[model samples]
Target: MIHNKKEFNLGIALLVLFFIVLFAMFQPLFDGHNAMAYLDNLYNSISKGSAHYVDALKEEAKTLAGYNVKVTMNMEDEAQAADSVALITAAGGTASAQGKALTINGDYVAILNACLNDADKLYNNDSAALKAKYPALAGKDDRQAVYNWYKILGGFDKELKKQEAFAQAKVAFNVNSKVVETAYNYYKVVPEQIKNKIGIVIFSLVFYVIYTMWYGFAILFVFEGWGLKISGH
Candidate 1:
């Protein structure tokens, strides 16, 4: 009867050991979906925020372009006037009185002010200023020099808008790349590492349990053998 009880106890222990090993080996498999969900959320948040920031930066660049045009035109005319004055001063009244050159103060002043006010409008984001500035260049094409200046200013504005668009595209592309990279690292790489570590731990415990079970069986078998011999069975 005692020998039967020992065999039943050993069987029960082996069954328990099998269940424990299986549970340990596969526990983390259930967490797979959960980890993926978190990674998706992180990707969405980063990508959305980055897109918004890029749009805002592009708008700012466009505004800066408009503002720069006005400032540059005004400064250029001012420099030309200063150069004329410097020449007159250096040569005394003789240079000014020379029939070889002339400076039209009225036209230059009008154009210079027009450019300055337009630039200020861009800075202030005033639509009214844009409307007011464009018409100032109309029909007064008599000042061919000033008209050329206006053309240059217009070209610069167009280039600036192009730059803004380019910048926006660059920012969006970089943001997307970063988000994808982060998701890949977290979900694919990090989870793989976690799974490996857990597998190692489970395997170690399984072997330990197997060893214990073997020792238990060996001990029981030896004791039974001794009893049988003592009883002369």
Candidate 2:
């Protein structure tokens, strides 16, 4: 009977250990408060709706800077006329080289079109070209600069659609892709924490079961000793 109990206990411990390892492996997914939170983060990230916009905006600003369009816009009108004239001289008006070459694609549709149409013309990394053109980044290795703005734009749109379908957000915001993506990333950590909790729980339960079995065996041994003494008396 003791042997049977021991075998049963061992089997339980092994099963518990197996499940604990499995949970640990997949813990990050369930580290949040609930499954819904996990789904929300996953959908946002996989679809690239939440973070892509920030990346796109950053890239677009860099691309514009490459064209020598002054990033710091003068707020005061005191310099307006002079600035306008300078702009005309540097870039020209509507038909100027600045206007034609300095493309602004805030929307994913427009960005994608520009990328597709000017694939050969556009550099994958603007910092290199910009440095070569401007001589400012000549010494610095601006390797972090990526010209994959168009790809990011597409990814953001697709991820946004997924986040909307998941209904994680209160309502689908028509704002830029990066804004939503930022929100999604901010909340993603919740799921990871939850998964860790599950791993801990599984490990605890297994140890508790093992402890209980050992305790039961110790009690049985004590009882058998008492029976032997009584028979001898």
Candidate 3:
């Protein structure tokens, strides 16, 4: 009775320990998923919010470009000959500002895309096509001067596409960064090193259990050779 009681208690203790270990192993996996999901949503919201600002910048650039063109056309009229020089100067200023805004905004989008490991190759190819269509703008040191309302209005569809692509890339980059950072932080505890250690420990315990059973069988055989009979009821 005593021997059987001891064996029963040992088995119960091992079963409890097994459950505890299993919980420890799976808890992190479950929690990590939750953390990742939350972070992804957060970054997606941020990207969506920032998209408005990018759109605003693009609109401002287009507006200034349009104003500059209007002023330039007005300056060409004989009725405005007396103020032509002043209008020309104003148009030049607007062009310079518009160019700077477009360049800065485009670069900002490109940098964000690069962060996400995306090169925005389609945008580059399309921009190249635009440049090809307007060779004058491509060759001029002052692209703003050549990218007047006439040129942009002539290819408004392509210009709009380029703007949309830039905005998309920027948002994608922000979202990707959030996902990466969240995963990195959440999985730190259950990293490869910890998993490897757990695997080794499990294998060692399995080996120990097998070896112990083999040794017990060998002892039983020796006892039988000595004319001892071991029986179980």
Best by lDDT: 1
Q: TM-scores, in order shown?
A: 0.18, 0.21, 0.20
Cα lDDT tens digits for candidate 3, 1-233: 23344444555555565556546544535436443453344444434333223333343333222221121112222322332222123323222122112211223222232222211211112334334543444553222222232222222223434555443434333333342232222321221232434564466569659656655654554454445565795
Q: How should the candidates be ordered by lDDT, best one leading?
A: 1, 2, 3
Candidate 1: list runs displaced more than 4 Å.
1-3, 29-233
Ranking by TM-score: 2, 3, 1
Point out the higher-scoring one by lDDT: 1 or 2. 1
Candidate 3 to truth, TM: 0.20
Clashing pairs in 1: none
Q: List, residue by residue over 128-164, the lDDT tens digit for candidate 1.
A: 4343444433333223223233333343334435656
Instruction: Estimate every model's Cα lDDT from 0 to 1.
Output: 0.37, 0.36, 0.34
Error of 1 at 114 (Å): 53
lDDT tens digits by residue: candidate 2, 1-233: 34455555555565566556546645554764343455556544444322334344434434323222121122223322232222223223221123213222233333333333222122222344433542422454342111222223333344545544322111112222334333322432322333434564466568669756665655554444334223554
| Alpha-carbon lDDT of model 2 | 0.36
lDDT of 3 at 97: 28
